[model samples]
Target: MREWLKQLREEKGLTQESVAAGSFINRAYYSQIENGVRNPSYEVAAKIAETFDINPARFFAGKISEPFTLALKNAPIVVAHCDLELKYTWFHHPHGVFTPEEVIGKTDEELGIYKGIPELIGMKKLIIEKGMPMKKFIVFQQHAGEKTYVVFGEPLMDESGEIVGAATVSMDVTEE
Candidate 1:
C-alpha cells in the first residue's frame, strides 16, 4: 500500500509538504506514515485523498467494502469523504445546500464552510497522529437555522496495513 500510495502521490505531482499544509499534520508525520514507521488516522486519510484525488475506500479496498451508504445519499444524514489534502471526494447533502461542486475539488483551507471550527482541523490531526478512528459532535449555524451532526471517521489502510486515506460520515441528529 505504501508503494501504491507513494505512486499515487508521485503521479499526482504533489509533495508531502503540499499535502499536509492546513491538514493539521506535519510533513514529517506523513513521511513516517508512508515509511511504515507510523500509523495514520482517518483524518490523514481524508487529507491524502484530497491531495491525490482518489476515493478513500481505495485505500482499504480489500479490508472493507465501499464505505458509502447509498441510502444515506438523500437521507437526513449528510456523509462526506476527503483525503490527506483536505479535499472532499463525496458529500451527501439531502437538502442540496452543499453540493459536490462546492466541495469536491477544493481544500479545507479553500472551503469556508468549516473555517471557524477549530476542532474540525484538530480532529483531522488527531486521526492522522493516532492512526485510529475518531468521533466528533458538530453543530452548524446557518442562515436557515442550527443543525447538529455526529461525525465518524475511520482510517483506510493498504494491504500491508499502511495508512492510505480516510472515510467519514455525518449523521444529522437534529430533533426538529
Candidate 2:
C-alpha cells in the first residue's frame, strides 16, 4: 500500500473525498491509488502532489532509474530499501543469494546471511538516525566461500524532510 500517502492524508485531516476533489480525481480512483490497487498517472500524481503541497516526484519514489536498472541487469549489485526498524521494504538483484520474498519484511540479522557482522546493519542504522550517507566494505562467508561487498547507504526522506528509512546499494567485490 501507499502507506506514506495515507499517513500524509491522515496527518492533514483530509478525507478521501476531499483529497479526490482537490486533485480533480474520482474518490474511488483516489482510494484505489492509496490502497495500492492502482497507480496514478503523471498528471494525476502531479495534481495530487499539488493538493498536498508535495513534490510530484514523491509518487515515483519506488521507481528505479534507467541507469540503476541497467546496472542491475549487467552487474553483481544488490539494491534495497529498509524501514527505520531495519526491516526490508524493497529489494532487487539478490545476486543468487536470496529472493525478494526471502528478504522483504526481514532484517539482515533475521536473514542470518550477515549474522555476527554488525557493520552492514550498523551502517543502515546510522544512516536512518543521522540522515547521512555512508559507505562500507563487508565480508560474508557464504556456501560459495568468502565474498566481499562494497555497500553504500543513504537516508530515505519523506516530503517534510524527515528520515523514514535507508536505501542501500551493494556491489560484490570478492573477485576484485
Candidate of highest lDDT: 2
Residue 126 local lDDT, model 1: 67
What would the per-residue lDDT of candidate 2 be over residues 51-150, giving only the tens digit for each residue? 9765565566558455666657878888888878887766777366787656665688888855325878889989998888999988867777778989
Give stretches of model 1 more than 4 Å off: 1-70, 113-116
Q: What is the C-alpha RMSD of each candidate to the true structure, in Å?
A: 11.6, 6.5
**TM-score of candidate 1 to 2 decimals:** 0.55
Q: Give the per-residue lDDT of model 1 (tens digit) for 1-176.
A: 36556655665687878777735689998888677677677778777766665765444532352345444545777666666665665555657465554666455566665422456656666676688999988776655677777878877666898765566777778788
Best by TM-score: 2
CA lDDT of each prediction against the hidden true structure: 0.65, 0.81
TM values, all candidates: 0.55, 0.60
Window of ten residues with lowest summed lDDT in model 1: 58-67
Look at candidate 2 and tell me the lDDT of residue 84.
Answer: 81
